[model samples]
Target chain A: MTQKDKSILMIGCFDTKEENFNFLRQCIVSHGESVIAMNTGIFGSTSLFPVELESDLVAAEAGESIGDLRKRADRGHAVEIMGKGAGKLVSRLLTERKIKAVIGMGGGGGTYISLAAMEPLPIGFPKLCISTLASKDVTRQVGMKDILLMPSVVDVAGLNRISRLIMRNAAAALTGMAKVNLKTDEKSLGTIAISMFGNTTACVNECTKLLEAKGYEVMAFHANGLGGNAMETLIREDCFVGILDITTTELA
Target chain B: MTQKDKSILMIGCFDTKEENFNFLRQCIVSHGESVIAMNTGIFGSTSLFPVELESDLVAAEAGESIGDLRKRADRGHAVEIMGKGAGKLVSRLLTERKIKAVIGMGGGGGTYISLAAMEPLPIGFPKLCISTLASKDVTRQVGMKDILLMPSVVDVAGLNRISRLIMRNAAAALTGMAKVNLKTDEKSLGTIAISMFGNTTACVNECTKLLEAKGYEVMAFHANGLGGNAMETLIREDCFVGILDITTTELA
Candidate 1:
């Protein structure tokens, strides 16, 4: 494989579900890309590339049991903190440049944990998640980044026919996206960012039209919680010239 | 006080709590504001403001049953739709430009519904909510808009000491925000928007430095879910020239 074959980083709880992990690994390798799988579950087998950072380690790493963590009654907060730690570890790995894409599979908790890990990546970096709750309102989970959610028709407990099909499609999607070289031209016309909601459609529409008429390119994001975050992410990347925040509905 | 001074738009469930309704009405009038309160609950109030746009009226207008609309499983989704209907009615009042600000009091469902109504107003509009759940995580309720949240310290069951204090502060905040004559200046410098999260702090910092050094003004919004949405609102208003969204963390 040439240097053009991108390295895809797959992060998830790979320990208990060996079939899914192996299937995803085989798929990534088959596509002629490098795979660096990070296992975040406390009970999972030793990760292929084990997270060495002390902060990335879960409470179980300090010999505390899951039951002990639960007894604190702030289990969700504890999990979130740990997810942030793991995210830092993932961020360090992403800075290395070899990891071009990221994909994860999980239920609700795992989805949260994986997203926390992927949140540090820049816009246009491929990110995907296959989860049972993908069909539901994942506005909170998927926020604003370019993370694609693939609904796992079957629970990711074991690799069955349904799981295999969903995982395969997700893998294919990531592989395709990873292979495609996104053209990032600095010389293009500057971009303008805009936010809109269903209620303020008229105002934003008029504003966007007026701006575009003036030779500015307008990128309107739904001012849902995540849409807002996505626009902000692009702003940090120097992607837009000015913002027209018409519908602050979500914020209100 | 003149009738113009008493023009206030009051929103809440006035069905079960007649005393609360009377209390809010008295509060509105005492502060030299006219009350145009809309009753969202099932029961009618003989003493307080009449239901200008009844829920059944809204249902008839939309060609849907009030019962069917109320049957939505997610209370949040239900409130969102109701808020839309309320927003339409309020917009008409706002057309007269008499509604200097909006003040609301409620629980989780009420706050959600009220925000939906208040969200369509442009930024700098005076919006206040006195909510029992205000002290909790209100990111979802307030989103990116600048809605002031005053914790009802006491449950909004009746007008008690704590309730009085909370409501007074809310009223005062809205009145002050609305009454202030804010000077507006046309933004001359090109605006740049950026999203930041703790994990991607380095990227945003470097990018912001780069943009500001190039003679652009930078507006950095935390890429938490709502911060992203707020930035989008500004974008739709034609506020920013470019966006550098490095900390696209919340999108995951």
Candidate 2:
């Protein structure tokens, strides 16, 4: 038996942006990659292309039915349930190691659902969102995840000149990320983190040299706002065995 | 009695980054603007300059004593309390109409506190944050606010070649925003919201012309993810009389 090919998980509301998704699917296919299209649209599914995961199945994952959601006629509630459903489904696919990357495009609700779906995925996983809200304050949707947001300069309404160019670029980026092989050195001393600012650079550099000389690998993070946040997240992920918090100014 | 001059709000942990804040204050002063510095630092206050609102005062706003916080020695808990305290204090200052703009610079904790302080400010108000985490995911901190984040490429430690340049630019930007008077045209017949995409541009253009001919002001928002989200926000702020959701693709 042969191993199944890892697929790019494409998520969106197929009911509305069917034309745009179809073009995106073609772009992915042109790169010789398989796509697992998932429809999160509550109203209806698309007939333009085949969807591996349908809206009904996605809603079912959230313990709801499409009919019930439609009957409720609440867009906000529907968005929440659909987002939860897609998240669970994507999580399962990740656990099965069936997906190499995830890509989604949409306006407000689509962006929300896509972010929610990608939220559970591990760090460094290829997660891309082609969204209109890319340039906006997406602090709530992104929430510390390394989710790459591509601004849809125009709306993701149809495959016009602008949409075509952006969607193609987005497809290429995602495909490249999915195909790249990251090399890691297995033999290393336990990883140590050292925080540094311009003021503490000299001290951090000296520490790094001494640590390396003793066969201990040292990773330095800038004591900037983002650097401190990143280091904290990595620490929570157990990426470092020891931490030398040299510049703790971020604790202000 | 004369009315008090509107001052730009400067927020940071003065105990540590006192030098940086002092430089920024001087920069603002050079622009002929007054600054209201608020210290969120829990350890101690700065002797470099007068801070109108001190760390102790900020902590007290959160119903905690600076001495008790120091005794706890809990960094995360302190960040939360200090952020809340600064937020309340800033909110009161805003309500009192004492500030023209708000600006802050920091790494992690500073970024959090600064953002929390500016979160309650009105939309369209000038809010600037020079942060190390500017390039990182700050969704939780920024939320839906229009906070302009400037990247402190280097750690915001002391005055260095990099820090000086970036900090100076940030100061200039904030001062410029603070001094600028935005003009509003008050002679509009009621504002109407219209959603549009590339595919529906022609239709929307025609509709907009017809609406304008009927003496109604038409505002078209691209039906992309961000556009939809922004439109929803504006709608909630009562900026529109009616909405023509032509392209609802974001609901995907």
Candidate 3:
């Protein structure tokens, strides 16, 4: 891949799921997209493909050496440190705008690291995680992020009939999202955030109609724990011009 | 409420949400359902209505006194202790068949305690959490439990136009679920668990069709994190007679 070409950031434990990631990379390439591979596997490296960012650097980012981590031989602790490292590194990559999107495939450890790596990306950044744990509750890991979790449908061990199809689809989806033009007119009077629930839906609808008529864009967030958290986070980031906290139930 | 009537277990911080809970209690009563209220509020008790289980008893369940917890003044610690107590108490109630369903409404602390308290309940058991955090990612707290989280479009502080409508709906829904007669035929060729993903949908569908034709019940689980965990959990409970595991991608 040339330096001038915008790339998809593919992160995973190359030491284990090398074949699956390779297949995913090929699928993306077949769709005329480039990939920047980052390894989060703590044990070792893979010979299948060239990795732009290795596990050593990831470990280093967590303020630990790969040798020390291996010497400790504590899987849980190691995974945690690696996840922190991956998150830090991914954040830097994001800040530099070196990648247009991010994708990862993993089982338990891999999924944890992949999610941690994508934590720094903003909402609608086209982050995808194809994992065995996809069907499991990942609310904590996903938080309020707009990360898309896809069920691998089978173990991402090797390229099989089922694995191949899923990986290809995941690749296609990522490439399509990365290449899409997301330009929208910022000509509205202002953006408003509204808290709403089923009971207040009618009220919110009326308010929204009037606000839109006045040339403002309105976003409604469910007063559920996650929805309220997201809205608050966005509001803190100064994304809203005004607030219509109709259903402040979350505060209770 | 009559002793002969199976009651809905209502859990919340009664000291804070007395009005809301009382309103909810009335709604349930209006629906011909009895409610057993349990308080998890640390500071004080409510005199508005009868509380079947008080915060002192809940705190005692965790091997601590409410006075000591109050003196400590650590909100997080108190919440954690109360949650554990509530969970233990709820588990005991379930074992004794004292309640048919569980419902709670709260903000952050209340939601946390309610979720923790309902942790010991089994899946298919009616459990509802009307919380501000409902819209938030609560996977970690919910784990593999089948808890229905309803977003409190407004805060649970007091009765308002939106809060009243939402709370009433919550109460009605809880009562309806508690009174539901869930009966299914246990007779079948056997139960089979199948893991599937979008890529392997066709194959799984064909297998399921053939299995039904053979008088066997086929259950499919998505290979995502949550889905895979739920399937494995149910399988461990000996809910299945055989396994298809077509899309075992979650294992990856």
Higher-ranked by lDDT: 1 or 2? 2
DockQ computed for model 2 against the true two-chain complex using alpha carbons: 0.03
Descending-lDDT candidate ranking = 2, 3, 1
Best model number under TM-score:
2
**Angstrom error at residue A85, model 2:** 3.0
By lDDT, the better pick of 1 and 3 is: 3
Q: TM-score of each candidate?
A: 0.43, 0.51, 0.51
DockQ for the candidates, in order? 0.01, 0.03, 0.03
Candidate lDDT (C-alpha), each: 0.61, 0.76, 0.74
For model 1, how many clashes? 52
Q: Give the per-residue lDDT digits (tens) of candidate 1, residues B1-252.
A: 222453667777666655665776775566566667776553344455565556655443334556776665555555655676777767766665557667777877777777777766554455667665553455555555545455453346655433443354345444444434131112222577778878877887788778768877676666756557767776775666787877777879
User: Backbone clashes per model, in order?
Assistant: 52, 10, 37
lDDT of 3 at A4: 34
Put the candidates in DockQ order, highest first: 2, 3, 1
Per-residue lDDT of B223 in model 1: 70
Model 1 spans > 4 angstroms off:
A1-252, B1-6, B50-53, B57-80, B181-190, B197-215, B224-226, B236-238
Q: Fraction of the real A/B interface contacts present in each candidate?
A: 0.00, 0.02, 0.02
Off by over 4 Å in 2: A1-4, A182-190, A198-202, B1-252
